[model samples]
Target: MGRKSWFWGILLCGLIIGSAASGKASDFRGNRWGGSMKQVAQQERAELEFRDDQSLFYRTRVAGLNCYLIYQFDRNQLYQAGYIIPPRNRNLNGCFQDYQKLLRYLVADYGEPQENQALWSDNALRDQPEKYGMAVSLGHLARQAIWYTPGTVIRLRLWGENRQINLGAGFFRRTQEETHPHSKTVFFGI
Candidate 1:
């Protein structure tokens, strides 16, 4: 009985390990759901900083023709972030007041389409600054606000992961008065 139990335990452990071993590497992409439908979650942006002087930046992304929402906040030279997605996008907008409900929630806010190139931008001097750190992948998202002296530099990132492929997207934000440099980086999977 002891030997049998040990064998069973070993089998279970092997099965678990085998399943995990099939997952994609950090930069590797893969197919999912037997090719019926593939999905990738958003990723987080890489760590970045500002230059000697720069300010106020913005960026955006869409989910393969779908929109994503982002919320940004500033406090005493510090920056914060929030996210929202609308119910309509979640297939839950069935009620007569769905629009109103969505407006209230902003859980899945529809923003712009996904960025095709490695970088994106809203300000002229910087479009996903090349010197700043940035990383975004499917299924997750991250942002950084660098407070250099009295100015503010904001970095935004979004990523998602599914059985199929990995995806990453991001942008940056800075204020006009702020004088901090910015950096940029890219992910390859998505």
Candidate 2:
């Protein structure tokens, strides 16, 4: 019965390997990485706002903020997804508070971030937390955080431009980032 035992052992090995591979390509927001546009479109259940050669866009509300949800696909397979929130209000304090609230949600989902910091281009306002948002608007500061998950790399970015606070969250296939070096964004608008 040595041959029978060997066969069963090989079968068990195959099953284990398959499950592990699938785990490495887990789902993001219920949409599996490598899923097709047709598949995502049906599940999206929202009127498509725009479509380019390689991505799909939809408008939605998240965290009480109006946002544009983007899905980036390569070869018709999903590789990235995110939400872009437009500037809500021009108040400085309101901007920073919004950033903190979004950070808490991300931390709750992905645990502590791998990197969380306010990167400064100019330290003029570093000592003034009250002016942090204004500093960001003036191109003096930016807050960034990154989290690595089993099969995804999650990123949260908060910055200001032209006196408007901007917040965005991106979920990318871990493998995709490794494959594409020097990619600031999966797509131009991302």
Candidate 3:
């Protein structure tokens, strides 16, 4: 091939590779969760103390879309929130049940004192007949008595409007232990 053809070939190949990478990134961007992790963090007040006996970490990724996941234990509280980056929808039914069970166990272990009453109250988990702003949406599929895991009760909270501002939590334990406390306190949308 002539020198000019060689240069063109290299440039075309570079363009193709770049376009493919960009396309793959774009796919994640489209599925991006909407909302700000910061906002979600700021909105949630810690309902319980985090026990430090277990391992946990906060993970974030920004490809075409921005996402955050809190890997506490084996499960991940993942969030893809913010403006239209793509893939803006997240249905976490499985995770939701996990949290429901955890919360129930926590309430049982700690006893539903006034402070913890809301977490255990049927009205808080399941929507009340009045259907007001604070009414939580607990699906019917996971309703059961409390069952503890990790030899300790852990309560997690997840929140978002179409993947914006997802929340996670660890419940207060009777046994005191040092733990790394982390939370998303603010999120900005561009």
Candidate 4:
């Protein structure tokens, strides 16, 4: 091989590697997607909430709301991260407002949602038991949104049922093998 050809070949390889590494998606707080949980905790100053064999839970705040950041790993590689907002205040409107606020914040960072939906139906209200009158009203006011990138997917949802408001943000790898392509695990009613 000629000297000039060798130089260009090496330069092209370096450019390919550099671009690939930089193009991966970041977690909600800007941590690298495939990095270790320890690195994430150190970088984000997150406190340990819980830990088991397969996942780690960290306490953090998003948009001034308490959030539990769950990190799911497969063979030591962080493949999924979830931002869970626990039920608070027992006010359906307040929960909806917080969900909207968080959605806007996510949009600012991740751009507009690819899928935004607000669903309501008389049947949804009717399906609930008579004892859950207020909850039926709240359940009729559900909203959900999703954003996608080549390397990650973000989902936001707000729904109320059984007198409890549920909301969350989920970030997941685009091609993880062990879990669903959408999210590591689904969270419902909490």
Candidate 5:
């Protein structure tokens, strides 16, 4: 190929790849925002359980982790979705491993999170035997990692206790409204 033709070909390929990657930001396992509960159920081939007027639940596996999903709707339009690790796999060490794996998968798909933090206070309760036992049993409550896209906010949280571990991810709509001022505003005479 001529030099000019090769340059144009490379540019076109780059654009196509960029667009495909960008399109994934708003999708959850091929289900995009505004998709209906019926659509998701059909896609997953799972039985959908209705929790209330605004929520639906189902079980599925994502990235090899068995999880239960809760889909929340506003006016019948899906506005939020959550993937939760099942209670059966709640060992503290196992939970941490699974959480790390999930985090890596999310980073690969969505790029780095906008805010990432991990917090633990093992020494805070060491002096108090009563609190220390509970604290240890409950493991540590890790800070969530959040990511923002144009119209969506994605959050990842992993936490557990001796008996139950919980790892979850939530995708929510990014509200467009501005926050109102704390104090009321007064208008001058026109």
Candidate 6:
């Protein structure tokens, strides 16, 4: 081939490879974000904890807490994965400690969150930081942290309702709707 043809050949090949790599759905573990549900089932590190029409939960441990690993699917294609520290027979103090431990783990792996919130609905216990957990259990406070990655958004939430504590992390994809003028996607900021 002529010198000009040789350079064009290499450039075309490079463009083809780059486009294929960028076509991947999203960044996550177990399998590609658009992979089959069976692909994730094969990689489970623990027993199945729960399941429904569109989600799977596996019992696992993270950050020293017994938790449930979550796998969510759309039309049987894996789209999201996360963890939830399950409910247990523990006090408010213990519950909040678990949240803190899990929070630190995410920060270590993904850096500081873009937004961190500890919202209070009542101030009766506001001055008592030591009893913040109690405030949470009483439905007076809720906490959440958010971090954004190249193609994913990570959220860590700790809240209470009906005197019950809840904690979990969710990984969701940020779609091209971010730039597509006609897309239906909406990103509600923290």
Counting only residues 3 or more apart in sequence or on different chains, how many pairs clash (N, Cα, C under 3 Å) in candidate 2?
0
TM-score of 1: 0.18
* Model 6 lDDT per residue over 1-190, tens place: 6533432232232110000012234355445666677777786667885566666667778888887676666678665566666568986778767878988997987789888888899999999988888898887988888777766667777777668677777665555224323223211111
**Per-residue lDDT of model 2, residues 61-175, tens digit only:** 7666677677767689777777766666567767666667777877876689898888898899999988887898876887878887766777777765566566777777777
**Which numbered prediction scores highest in lDDT against the true structure?**
2
lDDT of candidate model 2 versus the reference: 0.65
Which candidate comes out best when scored by TM-score?
2
Q: Per-residue error at 80 for model 4, in Å? A: 0.9
List the RMSD of every prediction in angstroms: 21.8, 15.4, 20.5, 15.3, 17.5, 16.1
Q: How far in Å is the alpha carbon of 93 misplaced in model 5?
A: 1.9
Q: Would you list the C-alpha lDDT of every candidate in the order shown?
A: 0.22, 0.65, 0.28, 0.59, 0.54, 0.63
Shift of residue 1 alpha carbon in model 6, Å: 73
Ranking by TM-score: 2, 6, 4, 5, 3, 1
Poorest lDDT segment (10 consecutive residues) of candidate 5: 181-190
| Candidate ordering by lDDT (highest first) | 2, 6, 4, 5, 3, 1
Q: What tens-digit string does per-residue lDDT give for candidate 5 at 141-167?
A: 444577776666667766545634456
Q: Give the poorly placed runs of model 3, Cα more than 4 Å off.
A: 1-96, 113-156, 164-167, 171-190
Which candidate, 3 or 6, has the higher lDDT? 6
Model 6 spans > 4 angstroms off: 1-26, 176-190
